[model samples]
Target: MTLNVANCQRCGKVYLKNMYGMCGNCIKEIDLQYDKCLKYLREFRSCSITELSEATGVSHQLITKFIREGRISIKGNPNMTYDCEVCGTAIRENTMCEPCRSKLAKETNQMHEDENRKKLREAQENHNTFKIQDRLKDRF
Candidate 1:
Protein backbone atom coordinates (compact mmCIF):
# COMPACT_ATOMS: atom_id res chain seq x y z
CA MET A 1 0.00 0.00 0.00
CA THR A 2 1.23 3.55 -0.80
CA LEU A 3 1.31 6.04 2.02
CA ASN A 4 -0.54 9.24 1.29
CA VAL A 5 1.25 12.52 1.89
CA ALA A 6 -0.21 15.97 1.69
CA ASN A 7 1.66 18.78 0.02
CA CYS A 8 1.55 22.50 0.78
CA GLN A 9 0.22 24.61 -2.07
CA ARG A 10 2.46 27.58 -1.42
CA CYS A 11 5.83 25.85 -0.91
CA GLY A 12 5.13 22.38 -2.34
CA LYS A 13 6.56 20.78 0.80
CA VAL A 14 5.26 17.38 1.77
CA TYR A 15 3.37 17.21 5.01
CA LEU A 16 2.07 14.24 6.94
CA LYS A 17 -1.15 16.03 7.74
CA ASN A 18 -2.65 19.21 6.34
CA MET A 19 -2.88 22.18 8.62
CA TYR A 20 -5.55 24.29 6.92
CA GLY A 21 -4.38 22.91 3.58
CA MET A 22 -0.82 24.10 4.07
CA CYS A 23 2.32 22.76 5.73
CA GLY A 24 3.75 24.58 8.73
CA ASN A 25 6.58 26.27 6.81
CA CYS A 26 4.34 27.24 3.95
CA ILE A 27 1.77 28.56 6.35
CA LYS A 28 4.39 30.78 7.93
CA GLU A 29 5.61 31.97 4.55
CA ILE A 30 2.12 32.68 3.27
CA ASP A 31 1.20 34.44 6.49
CA LEU A 32 3.64 37.19 5.51
CA GLN A 33 2.09 37.60 2.05
CA TYR A 34 5.62 37.72 0.72
CA ASP A 35 4.59 37.03 -2.86
CA LYS A 36 2.14 39.94 -2.84
CA CYS A 37 4.82 42.10 -1.26
CA LEU A 38 7.40 41.10 -3.88
CA LYS A 39 5.24 42.46 -6.66
CA TYR A 40 5.02 45.85 -4.98
CA LEU A 41 8.66 45.75 -3.93
CA ARG A 42 9.70 45.13 -7.49
CA GLU A 43 7.73 48.15 -8.68
CA PHE A 44 8.84 50.58 -5.94
CA ARG A 45 12.13 49.03 -4.74
CA SER A 46 11.42 50.77 -1.43
CA CYS A 47 8.19 51.89 0.18
CA SER A 48 6.80 53.21 3.41
CA ILE A 49 3.89 51.54 5.16
CA THR A 50 1.24 53.76 3.51
CA GLU A 51 2.67 53.39 0.00
CA LEU A 52 2.81 49.62 0.21
CA SER A 53 -0.72 49.48 1.59
CA GLU A 54 -2.12 51.49 -1.32
CA ALA A 55 -0.15 49.47 -3.86
CA THR A 56 -0.89 46.00 -2.45
CA GLY A 57 -4.44 46.49 -1.10
CA VAL A 58 -3.09 45.54 2.33
CA SER A 59 -3.50 48.01 5.16
CA HIS A 60 -0.56 50.30 5.82
CA GLN A 61 -0.59 49.32 9.48
CA LEU A 62 -0.48 45.60 8.68
CA ILE A 63 2.40 46.05 6.26
CA THR A 64 4.31 48.02 8.84
CA LYS A 65 3.83 45.27 11.41
CA PHE A 66 5.11 42.64 8.97
CA ILE A 67 8.17 44.73 8.21
CA ARG A 68 8.89 45.15 11.90
CA GLU A 69 8.76 41.38 12.39
CA GLY A 70 11.21 40.96 9.49
CA ARG A 71 8.56 39.00 7.66
CA ILE A 72 8.70 41.14 4.49
CA SER A 73 12.00 40.77 2.68
CA ILE A 74 13.83 43.91 1.53
CA LYS A 75 15.11 44.05 -2.02
CA GLY A 76 18.11 46.24 -1.25
CA ASN A 77 18.68 47.59 2.28
CA PRO A 78 16.74 46.61 5.36
CA ASN A 79 14.79 49.12 7.42
CA MET A 80 12.48 49.02 10.40
CA THR A 81 9.14 50.57 9.40
CA TYR A 82 6.45 48.31 10.61
CA ASP A 83 3.38 48.55 12.84
CA CYS A 84 1.89 46.52 15.67
CA GLU A 85 0.32 43.59 13.86
CA VAL A 86 -2.24 42.95 16.56
CA CYS A 87 -3.45 46.53 17.14
CA GLY A 88 -2.18 48.40 14.08
CA THR A 89 -0.07 50.77 16.13
CA ALA A 90 3.11 52.13 14.57
CA ILE A 91 6.18 50.77 16.30
CA ARG A 92 9.78 51.73 15.74
CA GLU A 93 11.05 48.14 15.68
CA ASN A 94 9.70 45.05 17.41
CA THR A 95 7.50 42.06 16.82
CA MET A 96 3.79 42.53 17.45
CA CYS A 97 3.62 39.19 19.19
CA GLU A 98 1.58 38.29 22.26
CA PRO A 99 3.83 39.90 24.83
CA CYS A 100 4.30 43.10 22.89
CA ARG A 101 0.58 43.32 22.16
CA SER A 102 -0.23 42.92 25.86
CA LYS A 103 2.28 45.58 26.80
CA LEU A 104 0.85 48.01 24.25
CA ALA A 105 -2.69 47.50 25.50
CA LYS A 106 -1.56 48.21 29.04
CA GLU A 107 0.28 51.35 28.00
CA THR A 108 -2.69 52.60 25.97
CA ASN A 109 -5.02 52.10 28.93
CA GLN A 110 -2.59 53.91 31.18
CA MET A 111 -2.46 56.87 28.79
CA HIS A 112 -6.25 57.16 28.79
CA GLU A 113 -6.29 57.07 32.56
CA ASP A 114 -3.62 59.75 32.75
CA GLU A 115 -5.56 61.97 30.39
CA ASN A 116 -8.68 61.57 32.49
CA ARG A 117 -6.79 62.45 35.62
CA LYS A 118 -5.38 65.57 34.01
CA LYS A 119 -8.86 66.72 32.97
CA LEU A 120 -10.16 66.19 36.50
CA ARG A 121 -7.24 68.13 37.97
CA GLU A 122 -7.82 71.01 35.61
CA ALA A 123 -11.54 71.18 36.40
CA GLN A 124 -10.87 71.15 40.13
CA GLU A 125 -8.35 73.96 39.79
CA ASN A 126 -10.77 76.01 37.72
CA HIS A 127 -13.54 75.52 40.31
CA ASN A 128 -11.24 76.63 43.12
CA THR A 129 -10.15 79.69 41.20
CA PHE A 130 -13.76 80.69 40.44
CA LYS A 131 -14.69 80.34 44.12
CA ILE A 132 -11.75 82.53 45.16
CA GLN A 133 -12.64 85.17 42.56
CA ASP A 134 -16.26 85.30 43.77
CA ARG A 135 -15.16 85.79 47.40
CA LEU A 136 -12.69 88.51 46.42
CA LYS A 137 -15.32 90.31 44.34
CA ASP A 138 -17.81 90.26 47.27
CA ARG A 139 -15.15 91.76 49.63
CA PHE A 140 -14.30 94.53 47.13
Candidate 2:
Protein backbone atom coordinates (compact mmCIF):
# COMPACT_ATOMS: atom_id res chain seq x y z
CA MET A 1 0.00 0.00 0.00
CA THR A 2 1.27 3.44 -0.89
CA LEU A 3 1.30 5.41 2.31
CA ASN A 4 -0.19 8.85 1.86
CA VAL A 5 2.10 11.70 2.84
CA ALA A 6 0.84 15.22 2.66
CA ASN A 7 0.77 18.59 4.38
CA CYS A 8 -2.24 19.64 6.38
CA GLN A 9 -4.11 22.44 4.63
CA ARG A 10 -5.16 24.17 7.84
CA CYS A 11 -2.03 24.11 10.00
CA GLY A 12 0.48 23.63 7.25
CA LYS A 13 1.86 20.65 9.13
CA VAL A 14 3.54 18.00 7.05
CA TYR A 15 2.27 14.55 7.95
CA LEU A 16 3.99 11.37 6.92
CA LYS A 17 2.12 8.13 6.20
CA ASN A 18 -1.23 9.85 6.04
CA MET A 19 -3.71 7.96 3.90
CA TYR A 20 -6.12 10.87 3.31
CA GLY A 21 -3.36 13.40 2.64
CA MET A 22 -4.74 15.60 5.39
CA CYS A 23 -3.65 15.64 9.05
CA GLY A 24 -6.13 15.21 11.91
CA ASN A 25 -6.55 18.95 12.35
CA CYS A 26 -7.35 19.39 8.69
CA ILE A 27 -9.86 16.58 8.91
CA LYS A 28 -11.53 18.40 11.78
CA GLU A 29 -11.76 21.50 9.62
CA ILE A 30 -13.47 19.41 6.98
CA ASP A 31 -15.94 18.23 9.60
CA LEU A 32 -16.56 21.83 10.63
CA GLN A 33 -18.75 22.30 7.54
CA TYR A 34 -21.34 20.09 9.20
CA ASP A 35 -21.10 22.17 12.35
CA LYS A 36 -21.53 25.31 10.33
CA CYS A 37 -24.60 23.82 8.71
CA LEU A 38 -26.04 22.97 12.08
CA LYS A 39 -25.29 26.36 13.53
CA TYR A 40 -26.81 28.07 10.54
CA LEU A 41 -29.94 25.99 10.88
CA ARG A 42 -30.21 26.66 14.60
CA GLU A 43 -29.83 30.41 14.29
CA PHE A 44 -32.32 30.69 11.44
CA ARG A 45 -34.88 28.28 12.96
CA SER A 46 -34.95 26.53 9.61
CA CYS A 47 -33.04 26.23 6.37
CA SER A 48 -33.64 24.72 2.98
CA ILE A 49 -31.24 22.30 1.39
CA THR A 50 -30.21 24.99 -1.07
CA GLU A 51 -29.59 27.51 1.69
CA LEU A 52 -27.42 25.07 3.58
CA SER A 53 -25.58 24.26 0.40
CA GLU A 54 -24.97 27.98 -0.20
CA ALA A 55 -23.94 28.84 3.33
CA THR A 56 -21.72 25.85 3.90
CA GLY A 57 -20.65 25.38 0.27
CA VAL A 58 -21.62 21.78 0.86
CA SER A 59 -23.39 19.78 -1.77
CA HIS A 60 -27.20 19.62 -1.62
CA GLN A 61 -26.97 15.84 -1.71
CA LEU A 62 -24.99 15.85 1.53
CA ILE A 63 -27.46 18.20 3.18
CA THR A 64 -30.29 15.96 2.01
CA LYS A 65 -28.49 13.04 3.60
CA PHE A 66 -28.21 14.95 6.87
CA ILE A 67 -31.93 15.69 6.81
CA ARG A 68 -32.86 12.14 5.85
CA GLU A 69 -30.76 10.68 8.67
CA GLY A 70 -32.37 13.06 11.21
CA ARG A 71 -29.30 15.13 11.77
CA ILE A 72 -31.27 18.34 11.13
CA SER A 73 -34.81 19.69 11.48
CA ILE A 74 -36.87 22.79 12.04
CA LYS A 75 -37.56 23.88 15.60
CA GLY A 76 -41.29 23.18 15.63
CA ASN A 77 -42.25 22.06 12.17
CA PRO A 78 -41.63 18.57 10.88
CA ASN A 79 -41.70 20.05 7.40
CA MET A 80 -38.62 22.28 7.13
CA THR A 81 -37.92 25.27 4.96
CA TYR A 82 -34.60 26.07 3.37
CA ASP A 83 -33.30 29.57 3.84
CA CYS A 84 -30.11 31.47 3.45
CA GLU A 85 -27.78 30.82 6.34
CA VAL A 86 -26.36 34.32 6.16
CA CYS A 87 -29.28 36.38 4.85
CA GLY A 88 -32.17 34.16 5.88
CA THR A 89 -33.68 34.26 2.40
CA ALA A 90 -36.19 31.48 1.77
CA ILE A 91 -34.85 28.86 -0.58
CA ARG A 92 -36.41 26.26 -2.83
CA GLU A 93 -37.96 23.08 -1.42
CA ASN A 94 -34.95 20.87 -2.01
CA THR A 95 -32.22 23.52 -1.96
CA MET A 96 -30.71 24.66 1.37
CA CYS A 97 -28.49 27.50 0.30
CA GLU A 98 -29.44 31.19 0.04
CA PRO A 99 -27.37 32.02 -3.00
CA CYS A 100 -28.98 29.18 -4.80
CA ARG A 101 -32.34 30.47 -3.64
CA SER A 102 -31.79 33.94 -5.04
CA LYS A 103 -30.37 32.49 -8.20
CA LEU A 104 -33.41 30.32 -8.60
CA ALA A 105 -35.74 33.23 -8.07
CA LYS A 106 -33.89 35.35 -10.60
CA GLU A 107 -33.93 32.55 -13.11
CA THR A 108 -37.64 31.95 -12.57
CA ASN A 109 -38.43 35.60 -12.97
CA GLN A 110 -36.39 35.82 -16.15
CA MET A 111 -38.15 32.85 -17.62
CA HIS A 112 -41.54 34.34 -16.87
CA GLU A 113 -40.57 37.67 -18.36
CA ASP A 114 -39.18 35.99 -21.46
CA GLU A 115 -42.30 33.95 -21.92
CA ASN A 116 -44.49 37.02 -21.63
CA ARG A 117 -42.40 38.90 -24.16
CA LYS A 118 -42.56 36.00 -26.59
CA LYS A 119 -46.32 35.88 -26.26
CA LEU A 120 -46.64 39.61 -26.88
CA ARG A 121 -44.37 39.41 -29.91
CA GLU A 122 -46.36 36.58 -31.36
CA ALA A 123 -49.62 38.42 -30.77
CA GLN A 124 -48.27 41.56 -32.46
CA GLU A 125 -47.04 39.52 -35.45
CA ASN A 126 -50.42 37.86 -35.80
CA HIS A 127 -52.18 41.19 -35.61
CA ASN A 128 -49.92 42.62 -38.30
CA THR A 129 -50.61 39.63 -40.53
CA PHE A 130 -54.34 40.07 -40.09
CA LYS A 131 -54.08 43.77 -40.93
CA ILE A 132 -52.14 42.97 -44.14
CA GLN A 133 -54.74 40.37 -45.15
CA ASP A 134 -57.53 42.92 -44.68
CA ARG A 135 -55.64 45.43 -46.87
CA LEU A 136 -55.09 42.79 -49.60
CA LYS A 137 -58.76 41.78 -49.43
CA ASP A 138 -59.79 45.43 -49.91
CA ARG A 139 -57.63 45.63 -53.11
CA PHE A 140 -59.36 42.52 -54.52
**Candidate 1 on 34-112: residue-level lDDT in tens?**
6687677877765666677777776665565556557675436244255555775545555575677788899999999
Identify the candidate with maximal TM-score.
Answer: 1
lDDT tens string, model 2, 21-136? Answer: 67887767657877888877776655556666788797776665566556665545333655455465554344347566677789999999999999999988887445667888
- Pairs that collide in candidate 1 are 64-82, 64-83, 65-83
Give lDDT per model, in order: 0.68, 0.67
| Total backbone collisions for each predicted model | 3, 14
Error of 2 at 75 (Å): 5.8
> Which residue runs of candidate 2 sit more than 4 Å off their true CA positions?
1-30, 74-140
